[model samples]
Target: MRSLVFLVLLGAAFALDDEKIVGGYECKPYSQPWQVSLNSGYHFCGGSLVNENWVVSAAHCYMSRIEVRLGEHNIVITEGSEQFIYSDKVIRHPNYNSWTLDSDIMLIKLSKPATLNQYVQPVSLPTGCATAGTNCSVTGWGNTMSSTADSNKLQCLEIPILSNSNCNNSYPGMITNTMFCAGYLEGGKDSCQKGESLSMDRRNKKEEEGKKEEEEEGEKEEEGKKEEEEEGGKKEEEEEGEKEEEGKKEEEEEGKKEEEEEEEEDKEWKYLMKFEQQS
Candidate 1:
């Protein structure tokens, strides 16, 4: 699963001074329809729409009250596609550990179902595990760099999934199964310190699914070959056993014939001895 770490903003509603996206560019308007801004009075975290009534976000972003803004491209301007809905309930993971950051996920139920449109839709959940080197992207309104101001426009950064071992090398004893890393090891591109929702590109995800299907097909083929080989081996053993039985039968027949001949000779010799004695 792609994990999100959001830096909660406590200041103004449009505070650009907080953590932001690094090495990212402005996303095409409404390209990320699932992306949503989690706000109380001010924007605090980014989230993704999972369904018409639910949004997924970081657990640490939980607040007593939250407003979810969907179809938002520019945070400052009012886009016709934008839909603002108050959260009816917020459910954070029960096992969330603040220190370890494990199970750092939350779900927000919208007070009303979001109207689905071209500019507002839910993202499909991933079905398979994200492998290393899988291409993905993150989107948020965070700053492009530490030295720069936050962007009002939604920014997206392309990144590759990192192996757990490699991520652990960077933060020893900190990586968890609930977390997976994506970004450059050299530190060129990354999501903003403020939360950016990570997502695997649909194309890449399809490719991964394709690869898995091919692997399963290969395994089935291998199993079939093994079955064929085992059957051939059994047939050969049965043939060998039949041949051995036939050879034993032939030897027994020859022994019986020899015994019959010996008995006939004995009978002839005894008759000859009786004729000589009579002479």
Candidate 2:
């Protein structure tokens, strides 16, 4: 199930930040924004941490309903493992076009600082100028086939840097100064865009509904199992107690019989009564 409802609003992708997936491409579940979920359920996009407090990703990655998880392994949605960081602010390039994919960049400010770990290191940014044809990595959860399904795992592709002229020719007017194109021209298992399927609002709604149904079913099953155990245990305890009570009653009867026999043996009281009658 999917929910088309954007837990958050939405935005476009970045154009110039071609910082590829040079390092490790971590794909984890849809945990909250900051914390880790049970599984790495989804990869919305690839981002580089510019600082402890800021992460640079495609603006499209930001949804009013979006969540980010840090330090995740598998894609399972866990409730509390991940810390959900709300986008304190979203700063997109001044001149961004949703149609053209130009300046499709944004900065995300985490409410709290990101803890630096081996798996979660910030990538170095190109400040001065990048030479043409410089090698870089592009990592994302985008679809391998534009028409087919998205990759199940986080994917990384390496492509040589293209001169601005060449990039413009490749993508026409889509490649801008803020954006850099790195995917393969032949288009074989090499592409970088943030997130896989910008889960439509309708899909998201369906997903949420499915989750709610699963949760309800799980709760019901738990309740039913608990009741069955309690009833079974009560019956066993009652049967054991009944068996012990029968044994106790037999012991009491044997004790009474021994007293009666001892009384029968004591006849001296009868002899005293007869002596008194003769006097």
Candidate 3:
């Protein structure tokens, strides 16, 4: 998906910054492990779930195909995990523009509704379609170190909402009213990196190889089946030829017997005529 690729590029362009936190800013963990696992692929740059029907994340997150695995505590590869839910649909704000990164928000609709537990409850939205400056928490699975995917805990940091005017000045032609900005005012402390691009590249290569192997094997099997059918058909034709030859031989024999009987009858008639003349 173009969106997924775009997101990786975007992360490279904006590496995460580890600068000092603003005075009141604090980072917290999500209460539920399930909440953290569902949004694993994305960095905590900007995203939220609006309701059971929709997960509101950054539009850039949607640019890539994302798997939202619910109910997992950590990010280890495991089978039959209880908190696994895949995203069925993605809806980015209609007005989103990548050049500006404005209207950066998006909504993800799940194929099935999520079960609510204390650890897996929905985050609250600001009342009244709140404007920027309304305090909110940002959570994600971004790497704590540069250019790496971080551990799978639901890491979050609290940020005061910056006014749309201020965000525009910072990102210019890169911010829109439909979106908001957070993090330190200084540039270095807040960023996403290019290293994530490498991880995705590796994954793509593996997938391509798998497909190629599958196709080759399928072709071989099909060829073998065709050969078998041809051999069977030839055997059937040979049997039919033998039957036709036998039928022809029987017909010729029947014709010869009928001719012999006609000859005998003609001879008997001639003898009777001669006897009558003598009398």
Candidate 4:
């Protein structure tokens, strides 16, 4: 799996300028109803509408003047669904640390409420923290590759939530309770650079319960079949064990490869930082 670092925004903001989607694809238009583009003269960050009059994003994306464009899919062209509204105020987290990117969240109040429509809607706030290994998705208009320009259309990527221990091991002394990491540890996929909101694909509570019940029933049936097969599978089991040993060796090689890729990715980030500073 590819690993990428992400900052979790809880009732706050995030900031990203000139960031793009890496290893993502174009999403269906208007599928992400809560997605919005934060702009001044140009797109700087991505945000999610919490309500008609407020948006959540990265604190570092704050500017003197920001325009929140709702229902925007293809930002390079005007779709009739777009609603451009200016920011009334921006509130960044007081505890935000730019150096370490701790508590990197912000909120923006819209000058006017966005009109509710099929293309413009608010996202439900998560009631609790997502558990490790949960699947989530991120959408944005950031560049698909490091060397490419920003994508005109919205892009989406699915990533898994990493456990806090694994995250700390990857970032080493940088993760906090307020922050969580999601991405592939093997490299090649990430949320551009910053200012992208991570959203969970939540199911209705009743639907989830029903699905769980079905899964339990299926597992019980499978258990009976497995018991029947085990009595006749001794030879196959031995063969499987031999295959597993080979798999372990392959896994060790893959781990070493991932470590090398992580180093390369770090070098790429450093180069990008130097380029940005010179520009």
Candidate 2 on 79-126: residue-level lDDT in tens?
Answer: 343344555666766776667655566676767786665445444443
Top candidate when judged by lDDT against the true structure: 4
lDDT values for all models = 0.76, 0.49, 0.48, 0.78
Greater lDDT among 1 and 3 belongs to 1
Q: Estimate each model's TM-score.
A: 0.68, 0.49, 0.49, 0.70
Q: Report the backbone clash tally of model 3.
A: 21
Residue-wise C-alpha lDDT for candidate 4, range 1-279, written one tens digit per residue: 111123343212232443666688899999888889999888878888888999888877878679999999999998899999999999989998877777788889999999989999888887677788877788888787665578899998887788888878877877766788777778677674446668876664446878999999899889978976885597688889989988998999999999999999999999999999999
What stretches of model 3 exceed 4 Å from their correct place? 1-47, 63-65, 77-82, 129-135, 187-279
Report the lDDT tens digits of candidate 1 across residue range 76-161: 88878899999999998999876676777788999999999988888778766768887777888887656655578998877778
Model 1: how far residue 115 lies from native, Å: 0.3
Task: Sort the candidates on lDDT, descending order.
Answer: 4, 1, 2, 3
Cα TM-score of candidate 4: 0.70
Best by TM-score: 4
| Tens-digit lDDT track of model 3 for 1-279 | 101111221322343353112132223433432243334454333333335655555565564445666544345554343444567887877987766555555677777777765445555443244345443433345555543455454444444455667766776775444444554565443325221211012244457788998898888888888877887787777777777777777777777777777777777887888889889
Superposed Cα deviation of residue 269, candidate 2 (Å): 99
